[model samples]
Target: MALPVAMLGPTVAQAQGWPTAANPDEVFLYPEESEDPVLLYPDDNSSSAPSSTPPLPNSPNIQPTSVRSLQLIGGEVLTEAIAQAFYRTQLGRPADPARLERIAFAIDQWYLDNGYSLSQVSGWMIDAEGVLTVEVVEPEVNQITIRYIDNEGRALDDEGNPIEGRTRERFLRRELQLQSGAVFNQNDVIQDIQSLMALEIFENATVAVDVDEESRETPVVDVVYNLQERLSRSFQASGGVSTELGLFAGVTYRDGNFNGRGESLRFGTQVGSRGLVFSTEFTSPYRDSRPERLGYTIRAFRRTGRSVTFSDEVRLANGDDARERHFGGGGSVMRPIGDWDAELGLNYSRVSIRDDSGDLAPTDELGNDLTLDDSGIDDLLTLEFAVTQDQRVNPSNPNDGSVLTLSTEQSIPVGNGNIVMNRLRADYAEYVPVNLFNTGRRQNPEVVAFNVQAGTVLGDLPPYEAFDLGGGNSVRGYGRGDVGSGRRFFLATAEYRFPVTGPLGAVLFTDFASDLGSGSEVPGDPAGVRDKPGTGLGYGAGLRIGSPLGLIRADFGVNDQGDNQFFFGFGQRF
Candidate 1:
């Protein structure tokens, strides 16, 4: 004797391309295709077609009429809310066999949307107590596998390694959103694909669901991920000029997937007309667990420039020739809390300052003039805390979203009578989308973005740590660092971006900033800082070009100080 085999296939009503209301198949699946099919629903009063005509001598017979009560079997995955929803849609209504099949489809759709790809509603039957018992089979994931595919359909890595089969599996297993033996969910699978593509190591990623049918009664699915790996490591050379730092050139090395894990490491150095800088950074998405992030950064830099000192008036006073050098390293730990993230960090720094101009004299802690030889170094141990909430649709270019960041840092003296200060800062940005022409396409629409940032320091801080506002990333109309380097500052900016063609765009922006303290005050001064510093205003228009490297921005701005400047940079100003 042959065993019975019944499969729920696409409904004939859907095959005829009928709408959900007319076809009825929108909520039902059929065992076979037909030109005219009968609707079905699982209810206590209906007679459902069975997969096999096995003996039903002990089963009770129920009328094909309105169902009074409904029950479910093999519905471990179904929730009480879904059951209530299914029940409300059927209770007190005339029972038709079609309604039962519609219920089955609703259940099947729910499972599919939740990633239970191999689950299905097989059939149903009425029990002796006039209750409907729906038969559902939910198959779980057996294994999740990863494979690397190249343009030529060859299994290879970006480095042309044929051992991609093994290496790819090892590299992806840690990043997999879903693990083996878990119930399949569509959302998790989609998220997995997104996560893979978001990584710099992968150019593209695709997921395919495969089901085993050998055990028709209980199936198992294997999710397969195919990736087009990008270059794991790369080196780039860049040159740029800044109003504050002058012309600079640099080389950087990056490893996106370090140690076969999803960690990233970057090392770079820049040499400019006025400064030299070297830095190294590393980041790990998860530190032994989910929702936790670990990162570390170290930097050494030195810069030489002329700084303006402010009393009743701004001027290049004596000892104006200045050079500042700093060496610092820090590590951070962050964990997610709802839509926000909380982070803590610690750092150590040694700072040295020099005044080459013999005319300028140093100042003591009491604000009294000191001899040039009295200058001393500052050693600091800093602790920092931050809370951030980012719901932006895109980090690189946001069209609709908001981001807020609040941070505080306290730098204590490593030795007695050293400079110590507490600093607090907050930044916020909002992006709103608008359609200029209403062409009916939503992608690449016009965006209005607003940003505001404020910072203040308490106690004594070096000028280098003071709030310095102006330039491409700051108040655009002014030269870099020309606005103010004071104890406290506030800045606000507004920008509008409209599309031109392809990846080309144009932006109009305006910014305003004001400092609240004199720029020349030394640490531990009994006289304290000045209040209500002068405000600076800037406005400009710019062109934006989206390139493979990132967004290129160029702007021509004019400041209230009668200074007109042009700036170029990469990425959004925020």
Candidate 2:
């Protein structure tokens, strides 16, 4: 510890004045390029080593323009993988050559059916690189051939001899149910055959096709059809229901080729609460089969309903009630006029009324009463005309369009009486769309429809004159015989539908009616006028369910006075 100071000085270099920053090039020097003795390689001759070969210059090699080969390697390899992926992902399976060929054949067949007989699809393999190219070729059509044969293997004409018309094939093709030059469909052919069978003129129909194999370039088709004549008479039975009437049924017989001259006769009867209705009709098909039709119908009917009494006080009369019977017959001729159809007819009717008052006395305005020994009868002659254009799909179930009908019936007396009865009735029914959100299973509902009907008597009463409205079919809100007058009366009804489930629909309906009399002062007439105005309103709902017997219906309604009633019927309420 007591050594000399000069000999014990620090060996490490000490910092001097103004210390400088490091030189980056010198700090990061390459070992191979260094001249230091410790950084020498074994192959170096000098003590300081050097790189074996001098580093090449950092410059791109320039070549002649035509010396390089412009070849694509990876693109061809990736394209095959892309094609396979497309086949699997888009088609959901591996693509088979046979299946693709079948698809081509189907497309060719479609083209051939559309008057392009020469249609072909060509497939080519491009360099075997899993790439396929297809080309479609279509050629022009020449002519079409159609051959007709009878059930007995005889090709006959109007004379029943084996003969061919000059343009037989052309005519038959033109008359075919399906058109040529249109795409061919097996389903269409089958439907055409069925339609031909439905005509009732053919018992058996067969179609066959033949192709020419030698001339594949110009494919030819041969068609042959065989048919059988049909027999003529048929009968049908149909029945249904309406809100106005309960349950009804009818039967019809038709002679298609009556006497080999196309005439028809029909006879039908409908029986229900509307009474017994029978009709007989005849038509000559030869009389203008296109637009104008001439036919005649002779109808007879008898209807009855309950009688009501309208007095100063609402009262239900006791004892025997009143009943009415009507018998009528008429003939009509109908013809088409522009967009409307018009009919003219003459009708004759006889009506009878009977009143049985058990122990009650019949009273008149002057307190006078008479007891009748027999019922009263009145004869009427009426001339009627009607014009209508009904565009409804089915009268029983209207879904598409509306129906408008206008009818006028005037009755005149030919005897020694100055009495006349005039009646004008018009019915308008339309279907309007309902903007209902969340309609569920129902596509649309809420049909805004109505019915307006008015009847009036225009002459002096001969003690037998009567105008009555009410009952189940007339005005559901009021009882039968509650509305009677010499003036005028009107009834209107509106209905809306709501679907419940599959094939089951519900309907809500409302009715309004009023009766008016002629005289301002209250007449003491028993059958003519009432002391107070007759007005009524009712609301009801019904359920319609689909069944083998058409639509089964049930309705329950109540009047303003809280009288509940239920109606069981079928079909529509119009």
**TM-scores of the models, in the order given:** 0.69, 0.47
Model 2 lDDT tens row, 1-574? 1111121111100111111211222231121333321211233233322111111243223222121111112122123343233223214233333333333333333333333333334331212223333334332222334444554556686697753322224323433544444322234344455544433334445655343434665343333455543344566676787332456676656554344433445566666554455555554421222343464445555543323433333222432343444466777777766676677788876654433321222333344221121224556678888887766533445544677778877777753332366666666677544545334232224455566766555543433333445544445545554544334567777777666776787778887666665322112344434443356677888887755344567777677777766677756666
- The per-residue C-alpha lDDT of model 2 at residue 95 equals 32
| Number of the top-ranking candidate, with TM-score as the measure | 1
lDDT of 1 by residue, 1-574 (tens): 1111111122311332312232332234322332212234344344443222111245454466556676665565775555556655555555545555555655665555455545666666565444666666666778776777774556765687862621345556666667777765666776676566545466556766666758655767677677766555779898998543568998989876777665777888888785667777787653323434454434333333443222222222342433444567778776766667778888876555444432333452234432212454556778999989977754556778899999999986665236578999999999988887553122234888999998888986665566766778888877666676667778999998888777788889999987755455533221233322246899989988866455788999999877889999976787
Worst 10-residue lDDT window for candidate 1 reads 1-10
lDDT of 1: 0.62
Can you give the lDDT of residue 477 in candidate 1?
79
What's model 2's TM-score?
A: 0.47
The clash count for each model shown is 17, 0
TM-score for candidate 1: 0.69
